[model samples]
Target: MTYRIGYIVGSLSSVSINRRLAGALVALAPDTLEFFEIGIADLPLYNRDLDGDYPEVARRFKGDVESADGLLIVSPEYNRSMPGALKNAIDWGSRPWGTNSFARKPTALLGTSSGSIGTAVMQAAMRNVLSFLNVPQLSSPEAYITFKPDEWDGDMVTNESTRAFLTHYMAEFAAFVERVLAHAPGHIGDEG
Candidate 1:
């Protein structure tokens, strides 16, 4: 009755607001859902030539995505788009010419920023790429928020409204994950 989700945080910074948001999601998630950060910092910039003999790091990242039941991506807008590290990871996941690891996986996106835009354009760019990768992303109840430092008490969001909304979204994500697993071919509801 547990679902393991492989997650990606677009920023490499230790103090990334988007990374904090992802951690908050984990704290709010139902017991049935567990998250593991899929590290992308070690991956080289994806090159097609490297696809034939992928580095062990890239292969491990791909395996993490393939083994997991779903994906959770939290990205902050960088230059009006997702960060380079995350994009490189995505390219690595969908590689070797028709051997994409992310194909048909259930996914969700969330992010926060200091600005009013709240990662909207970054998410849009990500959506286009994920569409090509065949990742079925949740379309409703999106979390795009302006970061408020005063609202965070340690890793948890102290603001009542933000906490409430995130809690509800995590519950919904639990159900979405369940449905994705139930319908996945050969899934026996115990996939890691």
Candidate 2:
């Protein structure tokens, strides 16, 4: 069975490496995973007044988040926290106080950075946000990468070991989503 997974990128910059990494992970997935991109860049800053009844763009973004069986967030650490654009996307999804799209969804986070730590701190920070939003994420086998020039093609993660790790991680995440959805029944987002 194929699963619809949301691949959310944190950065809006035209040259976002994080977005490229998300693309790479999707490519690494076997035929069983159907990954979709969630547009965080086009969304306006979230406001409660816009909840439920949303603008066209907000509705589209929310639909992507709400329908995906699981989430794969590839973020860049912006000033020690997640990028405002990414947070805004999440806020838009986790709205109306109770009808959160991510409530109980299986999610995973990975990031690539120019810095040495490879967005590790940002990953930790996002865990708190995921907890509050009730999105259950894989806590171990953390995924992170420090960008190395001449090491990767655009939208391709080239490190041999890192690629292997991510392939394994994604398979495990697929199983995790299957387990959660089996127990939760209809809560598993869109099973497309």
Candidate 3:
């Protein structure tokens, strides 16, 4: 059975390394998993006024999150926290209060930074937010990445050791997703 996985890019820039990592992970997806890129950049900020008259963009964003069996967020840390754009996207989806798109969905976080901390701290911040959203995240073999700006290209995960780690991370993430879907209420196979 195929699972629809939404890969969210936290940064909007065309050259964003975080986005590139998400794309690379998608490329590694097996035939049973279909990866969809969730366009977070194009969304407008959350507004109660707009909620009643939902824009096409908002509807699509909500649909993507709602339809996916799980989510993969390639977060980029900004000032040691999750980027505003990424946080905003989640805020939008977690609304019309109590009917969050992410409710009960499985999510995995992977992040990269030019600094030594990678995205460890941001993940901590996100853990709080995820708790509020009631989203179930993969809990083992936590995925994290750090890279030196001088050593890598925009799209290629060229650091050999980092690449190997990320490859292993993706495989584990896929299995975690399968396990999550297997047990979620009413989530059975492709129907998820």
Candidate 4:
């Protein structure tokens, strides 16, 4: 069965490397996976007051999260943590009490940065938040890509080793998603 995967790119920059990395991952993904971006650029800073009467954009964001069979969060490190825009989107998805849109959604987190360590710290912080929301995540084959202009050709990874690793990561994530969904209550492919 095909899986509808919603991806969030944490950077708001028009020329974001993380965005390019996300594109490469999508291109390398299996045919059974369909990737779509979940835009976080327009979401306002989340506030509890607004949760009572969620804005149209917030509603749309939540709807996107709810409809997806799986999620991929591609983030960039900002001051040793996740970008503000990404945090804002996460807050919107987990708000209004007992209405977490990310609950039980199979997720995989990866990020790219110019530094050698990449987005390790930011991913750690994100893991805490997503864990609290009960989002199931793929924890293995952690990707901490160091952005290098020479290693990429537009939206494709030109480095042979990096491309092979990313391709393998995508395959692993596809299997993880399918396994999680098959066991989810009332899922279409559920055999139990």
Q: Rate the local accuracy (lDDT) of all candidates.
A: 0.86, 0.82, 0.79, 0.91
Could you tell me how far off, in angstroms, the CA of residue 111 lies in candidate 3 after the best superposition?
Answer: 0.9
- Model 4 per-residue lDDT tens digits across residues 55-115: 9999999889888999999999999899999999989988767788888889999999999
Identify the leading candidate in terms of lDDT. Answer: 4
- Tell me the tens digit of each residue's lDDT in model 1 across 40-137: 99999989888779999999998898888889999999999989999999988888766788887889997999999899999999999999787788
Candidate 4: segments with Cα more than 4 A from true spot: 185-192
Candidate 3 accuracy as lDDT? 0.79
Candidate 2 residue lDDT tens string, 78-102:
9988999888888878765666778
Q: RMSD per prediction, one decimal?
A: 3.3, 3.1, 3.4, 3.5
- Candidate 2 residue-pair clash tally: 1
Error of 3 at 155 (Å): 2.6
TM-score of each candidate structure, all chains considered together: 0.94, 0.91, 0.89, 0.95
Pitting candidate 1 against candidate 2, the one with the higher TM-score is: 1
Candidate 4 colliding pairs, count: 0
Candidate 4 lDDT (Cα, whole model)? 0.91
User: Which regions of candidate 2 deviate over 4 angstroms?
Assistant: 188-192
- How much is the lDDT of residue 101 in candidate 3? 82
What digit string (tens of lDDT, one per residue) describes model 3 on residues 1-192?
777888898888877878777866776656667888888888888787776777888888988888888899998888888999999898888766656788878889878877777799899899889887778887776767765666566666667776776677777777888887787743322321
